[model samples]
Target: MGARHEERRRQIAEALLAIIDLHGLDAVSLRDVAARAEVSLGAVQHYFRSKDEMLLFALDYISERGTERVRRSLGQGEQPPRAVLRDILAELVPADDQRRAELRIATAFTARSLVSPKLADHLRAGYDSLYDVLVLLIRHAQEADEMPAGLDPERTAAALFALAEGLGMQVLIGHRNPRTALAILDEHLDRLSTTAS
Candidate 1:
């Protein structure tokens, strides 16, 4: 019963995400989610008492998937700092249709957060998690003598996040190419190498 409840909640979340992706977050409602999920409105209500709850669930679902993808790309066991950084950073880039859609959905949710403090809190946590991972990679690099001695992991991670988010927005708005964005990232890493020495 617990597993079935979890599955149903996941389905409703998926349906909410699809609606947000297709019609924008503003168009999403409990009724729309139920209709899309092919579940009753009461079912959505049972799992989520309000539209905010549903949107928050959708945001969390999307963020969890991104985190998992980053973890997978970073691979298991031993790996170099640069390799790990590249893998984790690659998760932020929209390399294909699915990723692009995910990015779009995240962007929409983030924009909505300006008016919704609850959403802002959720995305803030997500951002902090990614920053923590990036900082870990940088600290590892420094310890391994892969990065410069004076480099501040927190600041560098924040800059990388900004670069990734800015480039992602550009990609979503048709102002940038994924290859070019990647090249920019590569150049940033090269600069870090020079600074480390």
Candidate 2:
């Protein structure tokens, strides 16, 4: 019964995501979600007491999906620290249709967070996790001599994350292509490698 309940929640979240993707976040409502999911309004209400709850669930679901994809892409291997870090950073930028949709949803949630304390907290937590991981990876690279000796891991991690986020927005706005964005990231990584030597 627990599994079944969770599955139902997942379905509802997916429906909400699709709605956000197609109609924008402003179009989301309990009735629309129920129609999209082909479930009764009461069913959606059963899983989520309000629209904010539904959107929050969808945001978390999308974040987890992206994290899992990054983890799978960086599977266990004897890869160089720099190579692993490059893959991790690359995963954050939207390079395909699926990623574009995910980015759009994330951006929408970010805007919503400005007015929703609950969502702001959730977004803060998500970013904190990402920052922690990036800091760890940067520190690991420095220790392995893959990055410059004097570079601050925390600052570098924040800059890298900001760069990725800016590039992603540019890609979404058609100001830049994925390849160009990736090239810029590669150049930064190359500079780090050069500084290490």
After the best TM-score superposition of candidate 1, give how far the Cα of residue 71 lies from its true spot, in angstroms.
2.3
Estimated TM-score for each candidate: 0.87, 0.89
Local accuracy of candidate 2 as per-residue lDDT tens digits, 1-197? 79988888778888888888898878788998899888899999987777678767777888778878877877776766777778878877889987888888888888888999999998999899988988998888888888887888888889889898899899988899999999999998888667743
Show where candidate 1 strays beyond 4 Å.
Answer: none
Among all candidates shown, the one with the greatest TM-score:
2
Per-residue CA lDDT of candidate 1, range 29-141, in tens?
78888998999999989877876676677767777787788668767888888678777776787867777878887887787789999888988988888789899999998
- Whole-model lDDT, candidate 2? 0.84
Tell me the number of clashing residue pairs for each predicted model.
Answer: 1, 0
- The model with the greatest lDDT is 2
Give the distance in Å from residue 71's predicted Cα in candidate 2 to where it truly belongs: 1.6
